[model samples]
Target: MAWKVELTETARKQLTRLDKTQAQRITKYLRRVMMLEDPRDAGKALTGNLRTYWRYRVGDYRVICEIRDAELVIVAVEIGHRSEVYG
Candidate 1:
C-alpha cells in the first residue's frame, strides 16, 4: 500500500528557508520515493535517540520522518542540513 506523507509546521518552515530548487528537490523526493509501498526502503533508520525516526538524504539536507505503520502515514518532523539535523 502507498504511504501518505505529511509535513509538520516546523518542517514546512524549515523548507521555506531553502532555495527554491532545493525545496522542490525535497518535495519531489517525498512524492516519488517516500510515497512508495515502503518509505523505509528509501530512507535509513536514524540511530541513538532518534532511532524512532527515519532519515532521507537529499543532497546536503536531511528529512527526518516518523513512520506510523498502523495509519500508513509518514510525518515529516524536521528538515535541515545533515550536519545540524541530528543535533
Candidate 2:
C-alpha cells in the first residue's frame, strides 16, 4: 500500500530556505520513495538521541522523517543541508 506523506510546518519552512532546484529534488525524492515504498527501506535509521527518526539523502540535502507504519504515514520533520540538518 502507498503511504501518505506529510511535511511538518518547520519542514515546509526549511524547504523554502533551500535553493529552488534543491527543494524540488528533495520533494520529488520524498514523493517517489517515501510514498511509494516502505519508508524504512528507503533510508537508513538514525542512531543515538535521534533514534526515532530516519534519514533520506538527496544530494547534499537530508530529509529527516518519522515513519508510522500503523497509520501508513511518513512525516517529514526537517529538511536541510547535510551539515546543518543533524545539528
Candidate 3:
C-alpha cells in the first residue's frame, strides 16, 4: 500500500535552505518513490541512535525519515547534503 508522507518542521526548514532545483528534486523523490512504494525498499535503515529512522538518497542529498507501519506514514525528519545530513 502507498504510504502517506509528512515533513517535520525541521525538515521543512532544511528543504527551504536548499537550492530550488535541489529542493524540487527531493520533493519529487519523496512523492514518487517513498510515497508509492514500501519505505523500506526506498531507503536504508539507519543505525546508532537513529536506528529507528531511514535514509533515502537523491544525488548528493539525503532524506532522513521515520516509517510508522501501523499508520502507513513516512515522516521526513531532515533533508540535507550527504556531507551534512548525517551530522
Candidate 4:
C-alpha cells in the first residue's frame, strides 16, 4: 500500500536549513521510496525512548518518521545528519 509522507514543522525547518542539494536529494528519496513503498519494509525501527519511530537513511542524513497505520501517513518528526540526528 502506498503511504502518504509529511514533515513536521520542525522537520520542515530543519530540511530548509540543509544544503540545497541535500534537501533535494532527501525530497526525491521521500517521494520515490517512502511514499511508494511499504514504509515498514524499507525503514528500520528505532529503539529506546524513540522506539515508536522509524528511521530511513539517505546518504549521510537520517529521516525519523512516525508511521500512523490507521491514517496511512508517515510523519517525519526530524531530519538531520548521521552524527547529530539521534541526539
What ranges in model 3 sit over 4 Å off? none
Scored by lDDT, the top model is 1
Backbone clash numbers for all candidates listed? 0, 0, 0, 0
Query: TM-score for each prediction?
Result: 0.94, 0.94, 0.93, 0.93
- In TM-score terms, candidate 3 sits at 0.93
Would you list the C-alpha lDDT of every candidate in the order shown?
0.92, 0.89, 0.90, 0.91
Residue 61 alpha-carbon offset, candidate 3, angstroms: 0.5
What value of lDDT does candidate 2 attain over all alpha carbons?
Answer: 0.89
By the TM-score metric, which is better: model 2 or model 4? 2
Instruction: Give candidate 1 regions above 4 Å deviation.
Output: none
Q: Candidate order by lDDT, highest to lowest?
A: 1, 4, 3, 2
lDDT of 3 by residue, 7-67 (tens): 9999999999999999999999888865565778878999999999999999999999999
Error of 3 at 8 (Å): 0.6
Please state the error at residue 9 of candidate 2 in Å: 0.7
Error of 4 at 73 (Å): 0.2
lDDT of 1 by residue, 1-87 (tens): 777889999999999999999999999999986558888999999889999999999999999999999999999999999998888
What are the candidates' C-alpha RMSDs?
Answer: 0.9, 1.0, 1.1, 1.2
